[model samples]
Target: MTSHPVRPVADLFAADGRLKAIPRRPARREALLAHLAETLFEAGRTYREAEVNEALTSVHEDFPALRRYLVVGGFLARTKDGAAYRRQQRPTGTGGAIPAVA
Candidate 1:
């Protein structure tokens, strides 16, 4: 029988010595909008288009389009001044923002 060589323990350690797994969740449009709305509302501040884009940058680089989609989808409401958007409080009977994609 032939024997295989074994690797040393030191060789198995990565530079950081930590194994990292990427998150499996595919950031959905609706979830992103809901999270943004909740964060802004909790902060008691309105978010401008640029601010919204910046807020979502870590999740997706195409945040401008995503923001527009959220606006069109009714997850967020554009202010009358057209300078910012606000998270619309869901209707009393409504459950929550519908999931857009998995």
Candidate 2:
């Protein structure tokens, strides 16, 4: 069996003794946007750009584009200070129909 070379743990440590240069996978923009949209939709409420930005800070450092996408997609309504989003309800055909008196 061939022996594998192993680097010393100290070699990976930074001056502060923390692991240095550990790589992490980046978040997918599409997936992050979808999740944000779904979260807002399910909540049945609209959040301001700032609020949305704060909420998505973990997944996306830049939220301006995401906010714009949501507004354009009709998933969220935006305003200067905040936003108000309501689910689109289907109209019931009860207009002009008189109710029968029991």
Candidate 3:
């Protein structure tokens, strides 16, 4: 099977700044999630689940999936009770760069 090119994060969105689509490939999705985590959540601040949903919904209608992906992708962390959320300082093993999709 052939691999897909890694599109720039900007290309994932429409001219209006909303995400046009969520990527399916792991590397591409990681890049998008990292971008979203950085832009949407402030560092060193805790957020309510409703707040996270609001922020995510501003970008995409499917906030729940985005929320799930963010958590699963390690971009966002939530309390055991699921009432709170916070952006992780950084995703592990990224070396502060988005890995290329290959």
Candidate lDDT scores, in order, read 0.51, 0.44, 0.83
lDDT tens readout by residue for model 1, 27-64: 33344455555654444456676777776554455667
Q: Which ten residues in a row have the lowest lDDT in candidate 3?
A: 93-102
- Kindly report which residue stretches of model 3 are placed more than 4 angstroms away from their true locations once superposed: 1-5, 91-102
Highest-lDDT candidate? 3
TM-scores for every predicted model: 0.47, 0.41, 0.83
| Local distance difference test, candidate 1 | 0.51
Clashing residue pairs found in predicted model 2: none
lDDT of 1 at 67: 68
Q: What lDDT tens digits, residue by residue, belong to model 3 across residues 1-102? A: 898778789988998889888888888989999999999999878899999999999899999999998877668878877888888866477544422111
> For residues 1-102, could you state the per-residue lDDT of candidate 2 as single tens digits?
655454443454467644343223222333333445665445556444456666545444445655555555444554434444432221234342322211
Q: lDDT value for candidate 3?
A: 0.83
Of candidates 3 and 2, the better by lDDT: 3
Q: What TM-score quantifies how close candidate 2 is to the native fold?
A: 0.41
